[model samples]
Target: MTDKNIIWHKVLDDKKELPEGRVKTVTAAHKGICLTHYKGKFSALDNRCPHQGGPLGEGSIENGLLRCPWHGWDFDPCTGHPPGGYDDGIDTFPIKEENDAIFVGLEPEKPHETTVSDIMVETMINWDVTKVFGMVGHSNLGFADAMRRQEEKGNLNFYGIRHEGAAAFAASAYGKLTGKPAACFSIAGPGATNLYTGLWDAKVDRAPILAITGQVKTQVVGTGNFQEVDLVQGFNTVAEFNQRIQRDSRHAELMSLAIKHAILKRDVSHLTLPDEIQELKASSRAKAKTSKNRITPLTIAPPKEAVDEAVKLIKKAKRPVIIMGHGARNHKKEVVKFAERLNAAVLTTFKGKGLISDDHPLGGGVLGRSGTPIASWFMNECDLLIVFGASFSNHTGITPKKPIIQVDFDPLALSKFHQVEVAVWGEISRTLEIFQEEIKGETSAINPRNEIAARWKIWKEEKTKRLSETSDKGISSIAIFEAMNKVTPENAVMCVDVGNNAYSFGRYFEPKNQDFLMSGYLGSIGFALPAAIGAWAAVGNSRPVIAVAGDGGVCQYLAEITTLVNYNMPVKLIIINNNELGKISKEQRAGEFEVWKTALSNPNFAEFAESCGAWGKRVEHQEDLEQAMKELYDQSKPSVLEIIADVNLI
Candidate 1:
């Protein structure tokens, strides 16, 4: 009698398709079996070669024996034994032919065992990493299976993107919006390299993100295997913590440390998973780590002496200003209270455009190159400057000549490039709270809110003047942004790409109680659409998600528009079709060089959007801009509004 556990599965309908004296691979009971037909007899053996784990079934039969294609190793086709009595033989499965069909018998499989990937994924979930954006490939199948199990349990959500760059950008934006680490995954070599740009975006902007890369097997890591690269060396500079996952390593502990470094440092953490190690059986006693006592509170108060020095500076100045950067995003309420208590005008950097509502009494618009003149006017006349979590990038001309009090949680960021009157190293919100409490009886400082209002009035008039300066070349950027301001929801989250579109948005679009996300320090193009996808994933359909990009920027990741359609993300993409790299043209003319290679031939973006199953409209005239924008925003699905803007007017 045969073993009762053996089950027969029919794999081939007709033996004629395989031909005589040939070998082919078939799947039976989820296992690969090599079926060989030799001398009018059929035999089934394990498809995997004993050496290098190559697929033996794909090999050809030569000289009355089966030969592996990978290394030309020969084995007896009928018996499961290698040539020359090497003592290594492949396992054989019973085979039978019934009604011109081939069937192979396989024993019942053992219970599924937990793998290293399963252990690490559980650890990631323990740390509350709920979302992952990535591509699944041959090298990452085992790890992907682990993630699939987590998805089945409702512990994680995975989004498959068109490119690895989009995955990285999506993860970066998710981190920025939620202040939690979302992961980006890719295969080794080119797939991993594609993540560099967006990872740098997250790194420099201080967003927490985890990067998981699939590497070649550990045995072939240094052998120059196909699709293999030294991922640890490649990601060294961009990642705060980079490590390789090994069979002997404590897998769950490694994942725990990676997430902790990402969240605590607000930086990118990376892990390289080799092909074989990903599927290794884990220790039965292994457990996932958590954040029960590992995380510390972030609210450190400023030193008494630094706080006193700041108070003296604020009390002495007649005109004072408060400038916040993206770092102050999470503590805007405390910052507003501090500014209100001192009667100081609040201004923001281009990256921090929406930290304080433009409708606020003390709110002065962005303060530098992409900013309104009103912010520069206030900064020019102010006698004292109180900086909060701002990097004095040249793009944001926070004047170095003024008496400045800089407050930050990171000590290295204090006076990074130049000196200041006082450097208060502490959590930004806590420092602001101390300022609000310590400066109760100050009376010498001039209140700049009235001046702010007056300057805004003048700037609005100038904007109105620019709006009418349109030509037949195309619609003006001023008109486009003015219409956007009229139609965009107050609570929307805006993701702006790098280019003239970003500058124009900063100059014209007035944000009201909105959240702004951008590739701040890295200043990468093609960031908006992918980041908008990430923002939508973070907040769902609760608040509107908007993407602002130029024609050149949109072209970089145009395929992501389809991703938005598939997910029904409800993202409103506004493309300024200027037919040129407008910012580069401005730079060329500014440097006394003629514009070159800046011209672009663009397609009908609205039609392209419609083809991707989304609502799309092209606005060619100023009169139609507002209505088209309104219709796009009112829809519950993804949409695109392409505005033909004059490149020269931008």
Candidate 2:
């Protein structure tokens, strides 16, 4: 072939790398070529076997004929012919050997054409979806390539994680923090299925997320094709918007609706891209859709009657407590203001731990099972309950017997589990604005700051006494978190796992404007590390990102530490090592059953983190905690601080 418009790429540096009678695969200008050394000469032939698209380079040379590995088809060792009787033959490429090096020449790569993936990705980016976390595989190459182009243009970023489950969790955390949809990409079958837990977490938490999965060729979809699964049907339960992209589908509109559903509905949206259809050329008339004029502001106000009822209740409430849930994350400032104006004690659900700063006079610590005495005392004594954006999950234990006024943007979320005295359907901040205006500074509520302070002092005394509790197994959980609470950045974003560690953190680690993310409704383990990755992606290096996990939960996504290292994300990971599924063991004991199969064998996680090119430290004694934590936190890279703690002490 003529050399015009050709690019020559080095295939081998030494001819001895491939011994005689050996065939190896190499890529020259993005085309796979099987380089063969037979009879003291070199030849380059197409790597595919043509019949089954098997890699001919993996085949063996027997009887001087290179045999296809899959179906045992034979081909000429030097020529591109299959055999004497065969009509199908592969193409040959120009290969030259000079100075003990082999080179293959091919025509320069052509400019990429706009494909369905390009259109969809453009639409996704136009809607301000700036981050995607996942692995790139053969089936999702087209979509990954489109994302690569966007990355080059500085439009978005793609983080290749160790597992698809981590990708989903990371995306979910990003959405939860920013209220914008971040996507998670995966290939067909197992990769797509691995995203289940994280997607369910986002769905139950009302976080906006988008999931993209590849499928086998559309023509072979139902024929039991390799790596094929009915992704649309599989994602139906987790996603509010699930669709399969087809060649005739309106590509931009599909992406628009996917993000729209995720944002407006505050849930997961899923899209399945078939392998073959991903590369189909887009029509010239098709243009990517943007968010301009696409979405409406959701600042609706509550009905006048509902506002009047809320006002009347607040006027007569002598002792009122305002409870904030994760749903009130965005409107916490307004909620805090409302609490101050009404002189009501402010309590937060476990998920809403940091909504009101613990230092605030009226702020009471988290309520329910993972709560402090201050919160529980307020709940028992308060005559009026004003719930802002809380779902009243049993975990929060908002009393059903008390007269309650619940406000939420989503009408369905108000009084979701039981009946309340008043359900005000409106945006949280907007509703608070109306309530403040209608109340007109007329109220019987007394300031509970002194009582809240007294409760905190009592709780602190109790916690201090518990910190002295010792076990031969390890240090106390209180000690570990106490060190963290002293040194950790006040504005840090904390991602927590589901276990005794999380409960201890909720109980001991007082919040001071720090935000917390967890798998609230799903209560999935191993959420901390991946969620920390997502939080890092959202905030970059501007804020600290901390992940807290128990021994059992950290094992689920341990390899993700390498992902953090690869991305240079300086996330601080704290693992409470009790060497068992401590929570499950406690549950078993509570049910009067023997603790069986809950114990775990663990490696030295601090050493493992060091091996992964990150900083690490192990804290075994309470006296060593603050120093070790300081060392771990001082590292300007990804790090792990493993603390040996007593499970029972929690």
Candidate 3:
């Protein structure tokens, strides 16, 4: 073995070789590597993408490049340099084949340039203005420790939330915004349970997140000990995989699994560890490595014939509409090109807002509860509905009455109830980009600006009329969103909690780029403040992140106000003082159930923030609300702005 820190160990005897064009997982005593053999030579590197710790081993091989299973960053096996100018080296163990005996070497983690500096690098990465947000619990200690260590190492920083559920929401929103796995950490039992809402959201919404939770003490397994719960079972609520790192020998492997789950599944993963187990010292182990000898098989691209036909349908339609959802967000530029080339008006779902920038000529902003009237009418009147990269959720608040064209990576997402005219399946971004090019070649100049602006003009007229009639002088729900918008910058990021308040915030607030953050699928209310902090940390307080939270949500994680204050990150906490479960109240009124456990008394949150050494103010009137917000924003200090509103608005 060379002094470059190599270990000589036999991988296999002459009896075995990997299947042709396929990689093989070679396990050593304490580590494993995915070996790729090509032309009778082999190459290997660490198995995880340095960015989000995504699985490199499971990634496809194409033209001597190893593509990460998550985010598809391709890396050259020879030098371990990922695409997009990331030249980094992984722990490469030298392989020796002698007389049909194969051996490899492994080394300690060395300082080298990589995709991301550390987990903390997440805090610094641009989310297009979205922030890192989440709660911290005992169960998440290791994950949190890793994040904190990254921050301390000048690699990353995060906003800590009081409730684990909210943290999960923040993670979901952060992930959705950045296409990276944002994280949520909590203690075991209640902590894990609380995080389920966000986890389930991530699962359903296909938002990638890594959820970390603490487990019961290793020594007291199944003893009905305090705070002890079946984490593996509990984690089944939200995660694609519930991975328990019970032994030191399994930590690296479990981490690889976690990364694989988040990236490939495009869902949440839970990494659970017992309290003492995290502190246990283990011998140096080998990190998983990428293979050298495999190739990425090309899935036949969706026949271009079908896509060309879809384009023709768009060109002929006088009133065509494009519905952009999660799919569109993933393949933003491509979707934009397609819409523009077709001169089709675009309306995005809440989850996919800003998929096409608000500034785009064809932009209809968003379509839903808070969507402009023009957007709704566009959907209702369009003769053809072309939905790209999005699911038709009830939250969109409208169903297509016309023929629909749906394009997505998942064929199953083409319809919720409506039958699809043309269903094309492939990678959202890649396909969209391809479609755009094809459409450009087939079509001539059409004024997309005129189409979009015409719709926006009508919507703007209706919006103005509606805003004028609405009461803006009291503690109204609409007033809160409006006031916050007025005070915050155009680039402000708003991290919202789940429950009714999230609905209110998402609806009433028209956030542009860097303006809105929500766990659309997760819907965790307490996530607002923490997510704001994370966003602020990520962006270095360049813009303010306001957390619009309800009374119930605020109370669940009241302590995080102090976290904000202590960190001195530029985050504003806006508490909607609806004293009960507002969303449930609305549901009950709609004949769902009699509100029983939902009703509860609350505290003076403004004062609570003050107690935490933050500036706190309670607003009773609408006029005062805006003023107070202005004050909070001007102070640029940690503060809580409370709006005591009617209970109906929660």
The numbered model that scores best in TM-score is 2
Alpha-carbon runs more than 4 Å astray in model 1: 1-3, 6-29, 32-105
* Residue lDDT tens for model 1, 232-271: 9989999999999998999988998999999989999999
Candidate-wise lDDT, in order: 0.91, 0.92, 0.66
* Between candidates 1 and 3, the lDDT winner: 1
**Residue 188 of candidate 2: its Cα lDDT?**
95
Compared to the true structure, candidate 3 yields what TM-score?
0.69
Model 3 spans > 4 angstroms off:
1-152, 155-161, 217-220, 223-226, 246-250, 275-277, 284-305, 356-360, 398-400, 416-418, 441-473, 477-487, 498-508, 578-583, 592-600, 644-650
Best by lDDT: 2
**Model 2 lDDT tens row, 1-650:** 57886678899999999899999999887789999999998999999988999899999889999999999989997887977878888888887888999998887788888999999999999999989999999889889989999999999999999999999999999988999989999999999999999999999999999999988889898998888889999998999999999989999999999999999999999999999888999899989999999999999999999999989999999999999999999999999988999999999999899999888999999999988889999989999999987888888888898999999889888777888999999999888888988889999998899999999899999988998888778888888888888998898999999999999989899888788999998899999999999999999999999999999999999999999999999999999999999999999999999999999999999999999999988988888889898887788999999999887889
Worst 10 residues of 1 by lDDT: 441-450
Tens digit of per-residue lDDT, candidate 3, span 1-650: 44666657677686256543445557654566756664556765666567766756676677767767778777776557666785654556677778877776776545433221122223223222123355556545654555565556554446666666667766776666566676677778887788787678778878778876778778786999878888888777667888776653445545555655676567888877787665554434333322222223323366687687777776567777888876566466766676766767888887666566566677777788746666787788777888876777777865756778787766666665677777777676666666666766554434556766786777557545545543333366766767765667777766777676666665566555554566565455566765665566555577667777888877766787777777786577888776678777777878967777887687788888889889889988765777788888886788788887765432
Error of 1 at 130 (Å): 1.8
**TM-score winner between candidates 1 and 2:** 2
